[model samples]
Target: MQTTETLFETFKNVLALSNKNNDPSISSERIAEIRKELDSRILPETPLAELGLDSMTMTWIIVKLEEELDVDASGISIFEIFDVQGLMDELIQLRD
Candidate 1:
């Protein structure tokens, strides 16, 4: 299991890569920025459990992270990660 700090950084880096061009080094502010981007793009009003990431979006997230972190996010179960925090925790495990 990765530390929560590592999980936060993983989200930051992955979100940064999603933008196509940005610094990979992550920060809390960077993570918040990405959350805003997701809010705009997905228009999520509630938690992921209330509005799970669509299949295409889930695939994109995994693929993008795979490319950015060289981590196989394929093993992650999208259905199980029905919340933003869940997704972050799962990705952290994958990163390790």
Candidate 2:
């Protein structure tokens, strides 16, 4: 079983990758801001949409999780991604 810190790091990495690819010119300060917001959500049920991530960004994140991390996200429903913890749980279950 992966610890909470490990899961948070994975989540943060995936989001960072997505953000970098989506906006190559994004500043480090902005990235830090994003990370801060991401890190603040310690609760499992924090709504994903509340992160203010765009649809394209989410798609990239899912792809990165599936391809880079080998997390099987085939069963993930966009609507069912109700919280950060839920996504972490699914990733932990599907991680290779």
Candidate 3:
């Protein structure tokens, strides 16, 4: 089983690769805030919406996952997965 810390670490590793351009426009502080949220609430069953992730941020996150991790997120409906564990499952598949 993946521990909470390991899961966040894995997510961060993939996210680091998500910035293909190394663009300066990306806000490091905002990313840090998200990381802090993930650190505090890494439970598998926790709903992302419950963590204050608005649709826009979620969409951006999915886009990055698709672009950087080669994950086919096109078919995914954010409403379907509904929890951190489901997102982790998708990320695991992409990693493989």
Candidate 4:
């Protein structure tokens, strides 16, 4: 039952934490750009491929999401996800 806004906020917060921790060395400028993009361009139905995230970054995000949500998302593949909504749906299903 997570709203899109809540999902976006969680995604943003996780990325911000990742940036602060230098887990993958995502620059502050890049984080700002991502924030801007998420606010302006990202939508629930928007294809994840359109976000232009590299595999490493996407993998890190997925790993962080798994930890944060307390779900076993190990089998989920970024390439298999069609959009943000689809990812959200998968996570919801996993949680159940």
Candidate 5:
């Protein structure tokens, strides 16, 4: 099992790449805010919605995960995942 810190970093890195040059609406300040939310002490039960991620951001995240992690996120529904831990769990499963 991946450590919580590692998972957090993984998500953070992917999120940065996902937002890097693709969307103009996700301003630097917005990214910073999102990072700050990720940097917080997130527990397994923490809801993803609390992080201020919308559908578009989630879509970018899925795309980046597929491109960078070599995992197929096409079958995953952004709305189906309710928590940070669930998201990480899904990613790890896909990787395996």
Candidate 6:
């Protein structure tokens, strides 16, 4: 029984491997800003994942979120979830 928390952590570690952890720094405030940006720019059900997100897209999203949120944005596997709330919940857990 893998919990969502565990899945979120996995996402974080993967993001960290690429040096994209919370703005690529350790500033807590910056992380919150990043979350806001994501919320504003990236709609809950944005098809970023399904819109032909190849390796480059994945890398891009990974880098951008990591650079902004300071929290790990590697969880959720956005394409896998059935709805936006599910995806948000996963990311939120990672943020927490």
Instruction: Give per-model CA RMSD.
Output: 7.1, 2.6, 5.2, 3.3, 3.5, 9.2
* Global CA lDDT computed for model 3: 0.63
Query: Model 3 off-target regions past 4 Å?
Result: 1-7, 10-30, 94-96
- Candidate 5 TM-score to native: 0.69
- Whose TM-score is higher: candidate 4's or candidate 5's? 4
Whole-model alpha-carbon lDDT for candidate 6: 0.49
Give residue 70's lDDT in candidate 2 (0 to 100): 60
> Which whole-number lDDT from 0 to 100 does residue 87 have in model 6?
56
lDDT of 2 by residue, 1-95 (tens): 55766777777767865678778998888887877766665446668877678888887788777775666687877667788888877777776
Model 1 Cα lDDT, one tens digit per residue, 34-65: 66665445421235655434566557667876
Sliding window of 10 residues with minimal summed lDDT for model 1:
38-47
lDDT of 4 by residue, 1-96 (tens): 556567667766665555544345667788777676666676778888886677877878888988877888888876889988888888877877
Q: lDDT at 69 for candidate 6?
A: 48
- List model 3 lDDT by residue over 36-75, tens digit each: 6655555677776675555655676677766655667767
TM-score of each: 0.51, 0.72, 0.59, 0.72, 0.69, 0.37
Worst 10 residues of 2 by lDDT: 37-46
Clashing residue pairs found in predicted model 4: none
Off by over 4 Å in 4: 1-5, 15-33
Higher-lDDT candidate among 3 and 6?
3
Would you list the C-alpha lDDT of every candidate in the order shown?
Answer: 0.60, 0.74, 0.63, 0.74, 0.73, 0.49
